[model samples]
Target: MAKLEIVSPVTGSPRDVWASLRCAAEDAARDEPQLASQLNSVILSHDDLSGALSFQIARKLGDSELGAMTVREVALAAMQADPSIVRSAEADLLAVEERDPAIRSMLQPFLYFKGYQALQSWRVAHWLWEQGRDTLAFHFQSRISELFQVDIHPAAKIGSGVFVDHGTGIVIGETAVVGDEVSMLHAVTLGGTGAERGDRHPKIGRGVLLGAGAKVLGNIQIGDYAKVASGSVVLKPVPSGCTVAGVPARLVNCPTEAAPARTMDHTLADVVYDYVI
Candidate 1:
């Protein structure tokens, strides 16, 4: 894997990025003292700039604990865990550029795209969880949820090629399982039934499209190629090749053939391509 050349496009300086990142780190530490101490354990060799830009970003955005962690620490950690996180973010930026005519001149992904921050954060939490550091992992996850209005439990299993749109108010429970090529809109909840423990959340198969405000509760299975309509409350397992909608979500349309996996090629450039002139 190639080394990541992450520099602030605004300053065109790697050093400035590092300085800003440190400042952000300090601010995050101040907010979540315990997390700050733990992070310091890992980044002891580095200097604390006190006014780390990432921390300021979190503060400015009114992020909860989880959001601050995403910008301050988790993102960089993710870059270390899987270079693919960086690659995917870069690709998404390019895609947004290609598709959205308005974003041709924008330069600050760090400030604007929570999706990038969320994915980067997830990489670190996922790695931590794998290493049996659930406490720290859960702390980071909670921080992300507090800041971004996006809640993805550290234990939730999510495959690659996953796209989360309008990320605010999105929640994925601890036991939830999502497969590859899944696309979800805003206000979606892949949650559990009641307050039960252990594998109580929904299991989403591959190539599923969950519309905005869709809720799949309990230990139900959403088959591959399934579509849950907007504002639906699904309480049962859906068969493959079907589209379900409404409260107690029922099959609305059963196509002869299930849809293929949703395309995951949309780059960030494409999404932000349409910049407001």
Candidate 2:
């Protein structure tokens, strides 16, 4: 099989990312002797990004219907077949590392973050969906939901550099489109308002920050650099660079930050708090 090559959108190549992960794993193993075997198998034993990712994700998602080795082979093949998958995966790793304060190194997300793992698995499932393998795609989705408690439809279009923090209870509808650099917290839903068939879900633009428990429903557009406050129910189009809040969300004010998603800021101004509709 041909090797998978990834070029990071932020900085470095696939080899660089893999080397960093390996070094981190080695340091972690030395620091914590009990977990040496697990770390070695998951990171140090693999030769490349694809191999390590394949093993880690497969181990988490695999079950009786499909063994770990079988799932690993599938993930590896997908990564090899589509170079973009590797690129996206790399971008995701960087995104998580840069944005999450708790993340100490690239290896942390690569080895133990369920959000990152679930997203990568979703990428493979999305690939299968594009290849007319809907049944297999759905199976992967099922496994992802079972393992991560995050339910993203196989048909949802998610862009790179996206971060799903505290990923449990996050749902993306089949027609939802999440753009690059979007950050969403747990219990968020990009859903449809009703049983509308085609193009029913929301279109989330780049650099958008969705606070925890936010529900964006119907066929609407969330403009780039927009921020949706936690527990807000957004039913209409949110303008670019603005912040929205409340049950049927209203524009609170324009955010000061250029890209609120990158900053991961959840603070709303006191004036805006009083402006809730």
Candidate 3:
């Protein structure tokens, strides 16, 4: 997703990240004695990212409906059946680390960032949805919405290396297809134009950046590396490597950066708009 996928200090496979995460957790424990128990329970106790994430997700989403142990089992089952879930989680961690300025280590996203947490939990829910377990999947969706303030339908197909920054108020529709290396800020909505069914949401291409408060409605194709400016309402298809801005988004810049999501830049170029305010 980044310029370097297997480089040192960032963007490696799950095993490499897991090793670093454990080391970071140990370092944090030594630095802050107060959080030693919390760090050990969440990170040191687990053997891998899948195990750690399952435990963490259960702790966050568990309730009276299903105890934390049961939630952890469900998550573990999903990840065990499909190893890609853990791989996606690793890629997501890298995405957050590389894209967000506030991120200090992979441990931060794994333990604290609600965007990463919510997205990973949704992956489990998505697996459940695919298994024809709608009731349980809806339960996850509801809980995720309530806890994280991010509502993503279980049927959404999100790719790895996807970063959802400040995930509050983010709503992804059922048929939305987010590609790899995509990044979106808070209040971004991938929704339909009207009440419809069957492939109605946006098909976001790889390496796209959807700025804060951007609403991309209808069955639109956001081509790879396209950027939707903040507060823009995009109703039409955006061409590859283009930047759109305004109420009904218009092309303000084309042939933009090849990987806007990786760069995490949404600054619009100075251009004169023909339409009046």
Scored by lDDT, the top model is: 3
- Sorting all predicted structures by lDDT, with the top scorer first, yields 3, 2, 1
Candidate 1, residue 50: the lDDT equals 20
Please give the lDDT score for candidate 1.
0.61
Residue-level error in angstroms, candidate 3, position 106 = 1.0
Estimate the TM-score of every prediction.
Answer: 0.63, 0.93, 0.94
List runs of model 2 lying over 4 Å from the truth: 1-15, 273-277
Task: Estimate, for each residue in 1-277, the C-alpha lDDT of model 1 and write its tens digit.
Answer: 3433433322444433333334554566687787776446433234432222234334433354346555556445545566655444443333233223434221223335565456545655776787788997887687678667888988888765555665788999888998865777779999977877887999999878788899999989989877777898998898875677667676666641344335322211212211111
Candidate 2 residue lDDT tens string, 1-277? 2443455545555545666778889999999999999998998887878888899989998999999998998898899888788778877887887789998888888877778889999999998899899998999999999999899999999999889897999999999999999999999999998877999999999999999999999889999999999999999898888899898898788654688999999998666633543
- lDDT of the candidates, in the order given: 0.61, 0.87, 0.88
What is the RMSD, in Å, between candidate 2 and the native fold over all Cα? Answer: 2.5
Strongest candidate by TM-score: 3
Worst 10 residues of 2 by lDDT: 1-10
